[model samples]
Target chain A: MEGLWALISDDLPALQIAVPLLAATLCVLIRRPTAAWAVAMVVAWSSFANAGVLLHRVLTTGTISYVEGGWPVPWGIELRIDLLNALVLLVVTGICAIVLLAAPRSIDAEIPRDKQYLFYAVYLLCMTGLAGMTVTGDAFNIFVFLEISSLSSYALVSQGRTPRALTAAIQYLVMGTIGGTFILLGIGMLYMVTGTLNIVDLANQLALVGPNRTVMVAAACIAMGVGIKLAVFPLHIWLPNAYTYAPAIVTAFIAATSTKVAYYVLVRFAFSIFRINQTFDGAHSSAIAMMLGIAAMFAGSLVAIYQDDVKRMLAYSSVAQIGYMILGLSFANEYGLTGGLVHLFNHAIMKCGLFLVLACVLLRMGSTRLSAFAGLGRRMPLTFAAFVLGGLSLVGVPLTVGFVSKWYLVLGALEAGLWPVAVLILLSSILALVYIWRVVEVGYFKAPPEGADAITEAPFSMLLPTWILIGSTLVFGVWTSLSVGVASAAARMLIGGGS
Target chain B: MIEWGLYNYWVVIFLMMTGLYVVIARGNLIKKIIGLNIFQVSVIMFYVSMGKVRGGTAPIEAAGFEVYSNPLPHVLMLTAIVVGVATSALALALVVRIKETYGTIEEDEIRRIEADEDAS
Candidate 1:
């Protein structure tokens, strides 16, 4: 067993990507939904296990850098994992595994049986791309993986029941393509000056190059490009519709994982590649990020309150939640960065769990409209109970994952002496409360729609995964050792001990 | 004064702006996709142009060749081109489906149809 483990440990990085990619190809050939689902299940869980092992290795032995095909650094593609990406990898793959466990049932109710195999195939490809993006250390390689995941996502979005899904996917494609091109342009400019595509090499060379016009333009291009992918406020036009119209499983997976990965990229670039002091004429980047975050928080929460469609409401709320993460990042201190990083994990679990609840509701009710949820708390007791827990987490109630992150955020703001920003953080929580209360009021207080007594609880398959996520919100909230500990460590690494 | 020798950049900027303009200005789905392709082509050109070295030959190994054009950007651009084509193909496919279901590919018409659906 020790010998086998030794052999596998060395190649964990490659296997992390290879497993899903190979399994996706196999899924295409299998052509049976159940068989494809089984393939996906095994692949997702194994990748999750792979990420677990990788994270443990990173935590123990420090960063892991694996060169592709036995080439040297600055020439070969590297899959590098430090504390930050390790946490992100675990969040992404772990959420994917749990969501996949609950996916087959919802998928059956929504997608046609004939195309189910294709759906699984594309889903695995999307996972492969996301995992690849998280692991790679090459600049151009990130773009390749970004497109791979994005193309599959566009296809996945179009799989929704209504014709609007097609329009939404197209809009996403256009905006996403422009965003991608801007990134490429930025990388091209970086290469023009630095002459290296490797991230660490670029960072070193950028420091040597100092503040130059070309690098400044490159930084702006990359920021805006990643901002679009991150769905940061003004660039977030494509998100709500895309999430609103996508099939339930696709929405859940993308909502939880994709933005977090994009946030990882932004952080990687902002701090790791271009040090915070060097970006955008020195110190303005943080100011810009803080301003946009505040705007998104207020705007997104206000818009979410008015959305009658529950899924769309959650989508808008996602925009607001992204604000909190960016707000934490803009603080540029240890506590602020830690708050941001932990919120990444916490939000992933909270939002994915909430969406899973909606998926259960969608599977039974055939809609996620506000009216459809009337008296749903009584009819689907287990599912709505899960919803209430997830909702409380969203509102940052005590003893939930949401509050832990917000606490750190508030502390970070106070430490930074940005009292108004701290107050704004608290103010936004009330907005979250208002929107969540709207749903609760409709779900519990209103009478059931006529002849709706036949609705039963979601199948155990769905409820189990939903509760597992909801339960973790409380578990991690109370026991902050793992989540908060790793996050602060990662924060220290990103800030490089200055704080 | 602008250096005319850097004319490749001028062309790149021109194409990029034109492409972006069309993508934003045109309402037809196919036109939008065409604009996207054009925009991608400009980036591809930008990369390819950057690979060129003064007084250099192709990146083939041979005796007496002191300077060779960098081959990496060309290779990376090849990948980008393929991604662009894939995106265009997918966008066009979506347009076809849109036509099939909604019977119009104009953005305004589709929005009108959807708004009506939302209302009723």
Candidate 2:
């Protein structure tokens, strides 16, 4: 038993990725949807446990690296875990478990009867892909896992009942393929120059090769590819429809985790693998990131204001939130990266909470239109209260996780002496307030339609998960040590200790 | 001779640009997927080309084989080709669904249908 425990602990990172994949296959074999969900639940919770154990190990010890097949570096794939990746793994798997707990009813409502098991199967695959992408230290391995996630995400999005879901899935496929191809091209270019694909080795070798035209082009291709995947600013055309059209659980899970993982890849590339400070190309790339980050913050918020569908509005808001994250990274400073990394955690909580509440509202009332939200505060008090709090967090009100992330972002902007960017960050939060308030006003102050007066609360299962996320927003808001401390460590490790 | 050697890159650039143009310019869903396929194929070709070291032969291990082609990019592109195939299949399935729902697979027609839905 002691030996078995040692094996599990030593192999936790690989198990965190592998267990979900194995469970995914098992889910496909299971014909009953409920049974599939049970398998996924066991798998998801075990992954969450693995992430916890891995985080504890990384925190207690140091960075952990596992090479596949006992092959040394440069000859085999390595799964490396540091503070940043461990935290991201925790967030991805933790939220995935919570979302899966809330999924059975939502899946029942949103998907056809026979296809429900397949949904769980695909969900596990998506989860495995996401966790795999987060843990792998190989550059090309990122692409493989990225496609694994992207392909499953396309199928997951298409499982929605609305026909528009199909279009949204296709749209994402086109954009995602282009993005993945660009990333592959970038990796290929890097391999051509450096003759290595392990990220750490690539970074060391790049120090010798220095910046050339091919390196510059490779950098551009990778940034563009990851930018699209993260849906940073101008490349976010596909996100809104995909989020708006996918099933509520799908939207919540993917929205909370996938883009965060993609952003992790972007940050990993820019700061760690490429070591942006060491090359001239890094400066140009950071400039573009800053420009697009600012653009996305303004454009996404402004477009969100006019959207009548709450789901669509929240989707746009996510784009703006992504902008904030990218803006944090653009600064290339410790505080800036901290802000970015913490926001990745905080935004996942708030948005997952917010979207889960939206799902509750959708489950109660058939639609998610702004008009359908009328008097929901009185009718569905628990769910709307969660929404209001989540919305407050989204607007970066004090004492919410959103505020902690934004405060660091503003401080970073100020420290960088970009006062205008600081002001714009504040201004975008106000824009967030306006859009969030639109729903709050319509929900709380307005009257329900005549026949809808008898609407009640969301089910206990859904409400439980929604509140768990909402409660975290408040808990982590007050105690900054968990999110902020980990984030600062991650930031220092990423920027202060890079190749 | 330098220009002759570098023309390979120029041809790659040309194919890539043409594929990207078709993807962006075309309105038909099927055409867009086809264009996307073209774009991906260009990338695959580029990867294959990058693996071809000038004096390298097939990477079979024998006593005298000193110059072997970089097998990594070729292996990477094989994975990429599978990804490309999966994406195209998913895209085509989505197109079929789009046709069923909107009665047309043209981008403009889908937009018109959605806009009409929005108006009412």
User: How is the predicted docking of candidate 1 categorized under the CAPRI scheme?
Assistant: high
Q: Clashes per prediction?
A: 0, 0
Instruction: Name every residue pair that clashes in candidate 2.
Output: none
Most accurate candidate by DockQ: 1
Chain B TM-score, structure 2: 0.91
Which consecutive 10 residues in model 2 chain A have the weakest lDDT in total? A277-286
The per-model lDDT (C-alpha) reads 0.92, 0.90
Question: How close is every model to the real structure, measured as TM-score?
Answer: 0.98, 0.98
- lDDT by residue for model 1 (A1-499), tens: 8999898889998887899999999999999999999999999998999999999999899999999999999998999988888889999999989999898899898899989999999999899889998999999999999999999999999999989999999999999999999999999999999999999899888888986889888889999999999999999999999999999989999999999999998888888888774444535788999999999999999999999999999999999999999999999888998999999999999999999999999999999999999998899988998989999999999999999999999998998899999999999999999999999999899999888889999999999989999999999999998789989998888788221
Question: Candidate 2 at A79: error in angstroms?
Answer: 0.7
Kindly provide the TM-score of model 2 when superposed on the true structure, using C-alpha atoms: 0.98
Q: What is each candidate's DockQ, to 2 decimals?
A: 0.92, 0.82
lDDT over C-alpha atoms for residue A127 of model 2: 92
What TM-score does each prediction get for chain A alone?
0.98, 0.99
Clashing pairs in 1: none
Regions of candidate 2 where Cα sits further than 4 Å from its true position: A1-3, A281-283, B1-4, B63-65
